[model samples]
Target: MDHPASSRAGVIVSAPGRRASLRLSYANAAAWGLGNGLVSSTLVIYLGLELGAKNTALAAALILSAPQFLGLLRFSAPALIDRLADRKTFCVGCYAASALLLLLLPWAAAPGRLATPERSLVAMVAIWSLYHLLEYLGTVTLWSWLADLVPGRIRGAFIGHRERWLLVGTIVGMVATGIGTYLWRSHIENSATWNPGDRWLGYAAYALLGALAMLAATIPLMRMATVTTTASRPADHVRRRLAELLAPLGDARYWHLLLFGCTIAFFNGLTQSIQFLYPAAVLGLSLFAMLTLRSTMRLGQIAISPTMGRLADRFGNRPVMIACQAIVATGPAFYLLATSQAPWFVAGAWLAWIAYAGLNVCLPNLMIKLATPHLRAAYIAAYFAITGLTYGLATVVGGWLVDTFRDERFYAFGTTQIWGIYDLMFFLGWIGRTGSVVLLFMVIEPGAKPLSQLLRGEPQDATK
Candidate 1:
């Protein structure tokens, strides 16, 4: 691979020193966690516990899954960035715009009430969709920029270290939000006529803080190195650019990778709509308990990130990713077995995060490795775009499924009655997630060792 600063045309974009680049990357990653954790971590819980949305599943589909429906915009960002040739500016602008948009959530609720009427919910969805659209544009550029700043030789460590920073920020953010919500809930638990809209005030405050964090993170983003090579620049010919955009559709390997990604996205979307709902509505977990459950998962990711990164570096992303899927496949079965408020359920949830650490570290790197340098943005765009469309539809369908079976149950295991719809969906998700492993082998990385060699503990060169 070419050096971080130089491109195929032998042009040298002014580069930040390695230490500075890593520092900036770390800061940016932390900022992302802090800002996102505040809004996204407890969004579904807030909807039910605070906002009192009529249908939590549908609300989640609209607010959380709405981003995926905008995936085509992400696919086009690379070409847009190519023409602009100024990734840093675009990324910083996105951070600013998202920060401003987040303040509108509280307003999405009905006047003086915590509930989001359908009209307000639609407006909220539109705002969130716009926010995510900008975020996607920034992400395409940011990943491309990072790929340029960090050399291929140490990319694994770089991504691993970056994830570590992200975890730290996420943990802190979650804790802060958790504590704030907990105290607020305690004061109002017994109050008569305590308007649910009151909680939106607190969330609005939290969201503002998150928005500021995003702005703060942009400072470091602005300081990062800029790539301005002729090679990095997009083709001026509109016809040529259009042709390149559709070129990935013809590559067998790209299709294989895309298929694997879509499988994961579909199941993830299918389960994500109800991850909080199952615990709250089915398991009857309190807010504190939910916090503990989520914390366990995040903590597991933190502990295993460095090790997973090293494994990916020593072996290859493909093998590590396959192992991750296998580990995650068994997680849903544990949830199925949780019949009460037992410690085992928490323990079961933690198992999935152990696998998530590996997946989180490997998948992005794999996307980068799968594409040529100049075409990296285009490939990433396509990968996200395809997965986005699949997940977007899945989330809505999953939400509808939940409402359909909210009061239904069927006898299973000879006397135990399971929530018929959710249980069935969980089993299907397990199958889909596990089945995705089959397609991983079909993806060919240029310098990666074969799966057979990897399992035999043989080291293969990955110095592409």
Candidate 2:
């Protein structure tokens, strides 16, 4: 039996035990990433498009955004974690349950008496939403659990190392799935003996394999040391509990971080659906081709994640975050340049997105660093809730704009043809993203040097 701890502030395990836990954590990240890549947005969008659900922008938007919208459920996680008091059990149970739901996805899209194309699309969205809800809760608990397991001084390096493994797993899974799907489609198209509907069988195979990988991810958690919560009391009053849940709002520095995060999330989501639709619908990119692009992005992430993490540790997360955010904001310009005639321009967009690796590593490190140890879960949950809701709302609104102006076109000087709804949304996304950088300046990270000083290799001030 595992011993119970009073608080989850620092490394609670022995050095040997900590080493073992880190190894298991790396394994968990790998398996989880494999599962994630197998059931990625590329596959979901492809499945929806195959079901004839892309006739409207709203459907595609929901297919991509609805599951993320369920991130609002993260707010419930702190209370649930407190009630359960066993982060590992809550995380493992949620992951296992979510993985099981993947089995239903292929059937949800398969033709049947009860399933029309429209109905199948709705079912797919419903299933994914529930899956994400469970997964999101598990993620909250897992992060809170990890905060105690890893030391703060080397947190950046640890996250970077784990991120590299995660990317490796994702790249392998995506490439394999892409190759499998490509060959399967090729066979169905050429062979007279195969039923075209048999293509759904391929999806079933992917779902089963992905589910197994996700289940495998939980096994590592079972081996790791358990971190028990002591912050909440069983006899605490309802009103007091409510106040505790809302406590993060009283933190001014965390509030600034929240503002920056939400702003960035909204802009990033504003053109989320179009990112997939334009490549597939307008440019006629194949599933394999799209997956290849994603793999390339992951490869870039793998290359830079460790370096970015070290830079964050050396120069502070804020400076690295500011630089990466600026680079990522330019991504939409590449999308704007891509036409059916020159679809390769989209490759630049993916390349520009490689900078997101830095932001991903730094953002969470900062969040974990900022939160009070006991109330860490609540702080994380609040960040996810506000940012996620903003993102979902932006996606839905952007989709509505696309649907509302599907046929409309505009021009700057009435001679040069500005594209339709897509161009407009992409331009707005660029503007929103670029403008949001100002907010990052307001985010206070003590001892964090300015980007200028970091670039100049200046030493940190004695007082910071």
Candidate 3:
């Protein structure tokens, strides 16, 4: 029943060493990446390589769309998570379940004599979607904990530091995964040419490593600080619920922040939808090449995430976020020109990746500060829903763009059109993200005053 200010203000907490937080976040990020690299990156390859799903474009859309279903389930998860006394339980439990499901997925890859290959593939996709759903539910809940525990005064630094560490974990997990996948791909799966046995073996290897990382990741969350639940009065719960749903729009300032954030996410969705397509098409990279490029991009996130976090904490989340979006929006032009140069395309990809990481790390801190105390869960859930919904549909549009002009040779058009709707994505994505920037500057400004100030029906902050 206590507000964040009342509960958190006098709490004696040490700003832990960068080392400790980084290590924990790294371990956590690694567990997911190891599993994700296998589940997401590898399974995607598996669909094409093993199941022989020739509808790569459709398959891509379906995979990206998985989160929409997950988000739908997560619509209520924030409510439940906030009520649960132990975040570690939900976070670790969800991750463990996802890992277990992933390990069992090899069975879903191919049909036995009893189950047809088509049936098996469908089952595999279903299981994978379940995994995404679990991940979405677990992750949003787990992340809200950081907002709860870390003091907003130091949040940007802490989160940035955490992100950098996690990026390290991601890099380590991804690099190891890429090498293993490459080895398995070349020896067993045969990327240039396909082999079913090699694929089964490769998938198993990926699953085993993913399981191991999951186990390791689970350790820290179990060992980490717990969020002890507080009791709520019945009337208070109802009042809170009403407040939660409307808080984001209760103020003109928040209207801008939320508007800007959602806009940015809309663009990000469009860009991320085709993130894989660029390297695969414009640069003509293979699956291994795709993984390697992505891993390489994580290196930038590792280096800059903490810095951006610190900047967010010091300079404020809005400015840092603006910078982040600018960097993200502008990076695509480099990719457009790097069509002939693989390394340049990778560099552009890395820059975009780094910008996205910075934006993500900082934006959460901004929201944590802006959220109504009784309604924190609502704010978090709303953000995810907005982003997830955009991402789901973005993939379909992104796929259509690519497929529509996929085979249109540049020479035929006076220059090879940069692979389908790549140019349009760059343009549209920037437009959407820039909308965020304009909304933020014209509307929201950081003025530290209690929510009670607004609740008292005081005049709003400057937005003109």
Candidate 4:
């Protein structure tokens, strides 16, 4: 029988065992990120440009936002894990199933495979939704599992380390996609003998690779050791389970974090569709250029993630998050400068997005820190559900606004063509983002030092 080793926090695993498990976890994150970067990063462009999706704005928004919408299914993770009593099995099973489902996306979108482009889009959406549902369930369980596996003291560093590898993998995958798509568009698509019906073949090849990468991710996860969950007493009854699920809401600190999360999610999502649509449709950026921009952002994340994690560890997650949020809110301003003649100006926007690395590392750390150890899964589920739904709704609303104003132009002083729908959306998004900082202020991170002190080189509190 395997006995639990002692640790200050989280499930006890011996030092050597914990180190080995974390190494495997890092590998899993890298492989998973590679798959995500290949498929999720390129799907919108593939749909709009290759698959001929109609209602471009709404379709792009739906494609981008659908996964978050399906994040509602994450709420089922806790109970399912409890019933299964094996998070590793649940996570592996979900990931494997999702990968298998993802393999059908190319078939669903292939021309002549479905009767019409509309039908193809519908099929793609259905497949994508189901894929994300399973992926989200797996993600929730994985986070819960990691919450117990990684000790609190090093949680920030561990997240940052894993994220760095994940970003590295994403960067590699995106670079490959850029190169492949560039070659395809230049040689294959423009070739005299190329068939219009086969436009999706290039994208389909990448999708296949992405699916395989996702399946490969499961291998590392399988090697990681399982730890006992903190859910001491099982809630067998429906009422008890429901109550347990709802318990996170009763915690004031977690509630504040939830509000901050919802606010950020909404603001960040407000221009989701146009972010892709404007570049591809209006500015005429190639898939290669867009992927390059995304890779640039990931590279930035790779550079800053470790520093952010250290800051969070020394000061607190909130201080780092606050600073990062402020920087990220400035991103839309950069987008506002990009015009058809100066599309490269959008590079600044991508650079500004680098700040998200801090939030990505810190936010989850804070969430797990605030949650009750035994109920971490429930708290995580609630966080994802509420924030994901908010983001999806915001994206849909933004899409509607874009569709409604696609033909109209707005003037600032009645003499200048000051704004198009995309511009308007970007400005509004920036405003919402700037305003959302207020919610961040409302969040209470225990044992956190003030940002000013951290900047002043003051020693961190020993107890923290």
Candidate 5:
């Protein structure tokens, strides 16, 4: 004898429930960002310097490819969540798994314990792959779970608020990691009591602490389950659920959006291959300087997210996306110009961050908007899978290109010069991204206002 209200779809109708959910969401995002920031900035430094992975291309390929490759498995999440019939349990499991996997990563890279150098590298990659797989799983499930909780009309404001707090966590985490690493390095260098050969022990210690923080962050998410609705509807049969996975591919509109997303992912993978190496290898910047530069980028995101969100709500996600693509197209060229100077690279990071923040906010919102409520999870999965496969391969290709021309340099007119490997990458990436901007015009969001109306700053009164 279920009540009619209880049989209806799960939606938070009361102000108190929504407020409680929002608070928990903010707390979870901040804690998760803090954990990520602490370890993310350290990965490249620890691998390339501490582990003596001097083959830049190999290191970059391994680091960037893991996530993209594993992201394809996101297709399984929706079906799995349906079968399990509990998004909260699945998400918490992922969070716990990520913490354990991250803590276990350092052990795989332990220098002398391995039989050979090659074996150590292999072990590191395998461990990191597991860690990234869990990370993506957690992200995919969490997004779907949270999307169900948010009321449609207020989604823009809520996402903006969450992103702001997330950036704050990231800023604080970056500063702590940077300053902490610098001091640790200094202590090891100066202390007669410390062994130089054991410097990697410091990375392991920090990773353990970060892992603990990741687990601690789940407290908020767990508490939120009691106050919020984590399930959308009942599960379907395996065959029926499997058939629904193809629905996104069948829908012309969803297909176009997926293509648009995949295009961006391809170009991003190209640039991400060198994101860490270009600054570190070319400019010889230290960990502290790199993290400081990243913190500046986060500061920009924090400042711009609110405006971007409101604009998306007012105009449309399509226009915001177009503007973001235009800005993103300029990023690689900016990096090309940064060949010899730290300030040039800093400027590039700032510009890229601002553009990326807008895209980050709008793209997901648009995807959710386009998707039918029952199939939203599957739609998100399809988007990630298509993009992930293409992006993963592109990343490996970028790595190969860099390795081919690492020692080669091209001299220009008079005293002007360029590092051959990175220069080619930046220039080519610029061309690809610039060309991709045209695809946005082809995407038709049915609910979005016309481009002319958006340009005129007219609100779409029709948008629900």
Candidate 6:
């Protein structure tokens, strides 16, 4: 039996207040984020650079066409999550399969005798694509549970606290990854004591570990599940609210929002694509150094998150998002200005976190608030699908730009021709985001205020 609004909804720890719930959520997020970072940041690089795959091949791998895949998955979600049942079991099953796919990565990385270089690389990409699709579906399903469990009022602070801890774990994981890279430069695995294939093999092990971590965290959540089939009065009003809420998307507000949001999505994706390349190629930094950068930036989020969360709750989600967008949109442009100075790394890393933590804390909260509870999961999925598909389009365009130019980004010394490509992405994305910011002001609804505000922010007589 699922109790939709109980604070204890499937949460393992039997406790009260904001702090305890925050801890429980953080544990869950850390496990999920670590697994995701490993797959997204490293998978493409492991293919193109390590396996020697070419530009177009890499683009296809990057595309993976996940957005379209989820559109079909969306149809089945209602029954599986809301109607048919067994969402938890389904999530566990998906994780198990994903872990299995991960273990194959090391074997695929091995130069094979049966398959040609191209064929082996293609097979590996296919495996990774399948893994991502499964993971994405599982994630959407899992996220639905969180939305059902957490109340609307504290969502911002709740998620912020959760991300703070997760960022800490992410830092640890990133540091470990950097160590693996540094060791790879030598004849040994993560250190001088191992063999050449140790790096990828060890990574496969990390993937398995990630799945196990998710299970560990989820069990705590599931421990709190109801033993009997519980029922609720159907939320008919919620449905009515959704129809009204989504109506704005059909008007000018929708285009304005989509254009701006997609722009932010595109530049963010571009940075993501080039991120692995920068550490290994441009900075002349060892994999370890890159990890250090990732860790340092993420660590900063610990302080930034609480501040950002409360500010969003106190002021508004829009202004906080604008502040974040500025840091992110303008951040990349700083790279071209950076010389061989030591502070360059510090500057870029700060800009990166401003975007990273802000988005993580705000976007999910904003989406949840904007949509009605009945439609929350579906709306969130739709949001993810749009952003992800846009991400695919952006990555493809960037890849083409990189390829058509012969991958020779530099025409002059002290100038980053390729870096300029990345900068233009941010410049345009900022304009796009600014447009969305403008829309938020128009469609802003007072009813979306946090739960804590219910007593103060609402009309007092209505409370009676």
Highest lDDT against the true fold, candidate: 4
- Badly placed stretches (over 4 Å) of model 3 are 1-6, 9-26, 42-49, 82-86, 111-121, 189-197, 229-232, 235-243, 249-251, 271-273, 340-346, 404-427, 430-436, 443-445, 448-464
Residues 269-365 of candidate 6 have per-residue lDDT tens digits of 5555544554455555555565566677788887788777776666556656766765655555454454345425435744465566777787777
lDDT of 1 at 76: 77
lDDT: the better of candidates 4 and 6 = 4
For model 5, residues 129-166, the per-residue Cα lDDT tens digits are 77777777777777777676766666776777788878
**Separate clash counts for every candidate:** 1, 0, 2, 0, 0, 3
lDDT of 2 by residue, 358-398 (tens): 98898888888777776778888888888888888888887
* lDDT on C-alpha atoms for all candidate structures: 0.73, 0.81, 0.61, 0.82, 0.74, 0.55
Error of 2 at 199 (Å): 3.6
Error of 2 at 12 (Å): 2.9
Model 1 regions lying over 4 Å from their true place? 1-16, 110-116, 190-197, 230-236, 340-347, 411-419
CA RMSD of all predictions: 2.9, 3.1, 6.3, 2.5, 3.5, 6.2
Q: How does model 3 fare in lDDT?
A: 0.61
Off by over 4 Å in 5: 1-14, 41-45, 192-195, 226-236, 340-346, 409-419, 461-464
lDDT for 69 (candidate 3): 52
| Clash pairs detected, candidate 3 | 410-415, 410-416
Please provide TM-scores, in order, for all candidate models, with all chains considered together: 0.91, 0.93, 0.80, 0.95, 0.91, 0.76
For model 1 the TM-score comes to 0.91
> For model 1, what is the alpha-carbon lDDT of residue 409?
81
Question: Which lDDT value does model 1 have at 137?
Answer: 81
Q: Pick the candidate with the highest TM-score.
A: 4
lDDT of 2: 0.81
Q: What is the lDDT of residue 213 in candidate 6?
A: 52
